[model samples]
Target: MYLIAGLQPPMDMRLFLHGFQDFFPSKAWQRTPVLYLPLVAFGRMTPMAWEELDQSLYTLHLPTPVTLRHTGFDVTLKRNRIILEATMEASVIDHLSVKIRNLAQRAGVSATRSLLPSGIPLADITDVDPSVCNLWLATHRHRFASTEEVCEFTVFKTGKNRENTFQEVMSDYQFADLFTPPSELL
Candidate 1:
């Protein structure tokens, strides 16, 4: 199943930190809230590349899309929502329902006071049509003269029509980062 979660801004990173644990309770025993890389990979990362990866993982205010791996899920955070692809089985869906509820309840704690439960509630989530992204790419790929132009369009359109402003800063830097080929980042 594909899912989309519409999140609002001024976000507290701890919400996600705790939400990750909530989603995979079994992994809670091993939780360190840290992602480890092999020494060889760590040594090979250029300062800039390391900084880019660090920002993607640690920053809560990022406007560009980024994917972070949790215990059993790969969550892609975009300007408007968090996206995930998972099984549509009844058990998995039930687990999701419980996890989101647990996370929402935790959001009310003083430590996560900046977060709004409504912003992360089930009401804001929807089952996604996976092909929408593919259809979007197919329709728009030919419209731009260059990849950079396509990226610029992507950045500019993010969260612009939403009732709430999520991004405080928009920059040319995001245009390049968002569309850079994955191979180039490694």
Candidate 2:
């Protein structure tokens, strides 16, 4: 696990991405590994924008290549975006869930025994003007409470909308259900 100095609870424990586009890298784009920095320092950092998270934290290098496939999840690349659909097997989910639980424990937060969806989707377009057909980054907030403390997980998604502007797309919550469990199906 990657650890940074001075990173406090909640704020410190987040999945930071770098050199990624629409949850997957393009053929010409080099893959930058995702870092799990649970106890890093965030005092010297400021959030300029969602796409600029690399500026806030120090990146750690691992011995092996880290990808979503390593965690036993299936990733599909579509025409303009990447999709990550979870499997029903508990082992696969536990692989990622364990990391989250460990982070929460280090932060002193009492997290539930379950793993909530924290899938992130990102998009990068180079050929078009962003103002007209821009890519939008959306975040979903999840609040988990126990008898003592409350833990919040902010999941992110990125998409392109031709019909709506960047501001309008960012303000939309119609796709928020993607991160939530389906009551009818469950």
Off by over 4 Å in 2: 1-63, 69-93, 116-186
- Against the reference, the lDDT scores of all candidates come to 0.26, 0.26
| Candidate 1 per-residue C-alpha lDDT over 78-162 given as tens digits, one digit per residue, 9 for 90 to 100 | 3565433211112122232233334423433111111121111111122344464344334433321111111111111113233
Candidate 1: 10-residue stretch with minimal lDDT:
34-43
RMSD of each: 19.3, 17.8
TM-scores across all candidates? Answer: 0.17, 0.20
Model 1 quality (TM-score) = 0.17
Badly placed stretches (over 4 Å) of model 1 are 1-14, 20-28, 35-186
| Backbone clash count, each prediction separately | 1, 5
Displacement of residue 153 (Cα, Å) in model 1 is: 20
lDDT of 2 by residue, 98-179 (tens): 5433443444433224323333222323333433331222121121111111122222222232111121111111111224
Clashing pairs in 2: 6-41, 7-40, 7-41, 22-122, 121-158
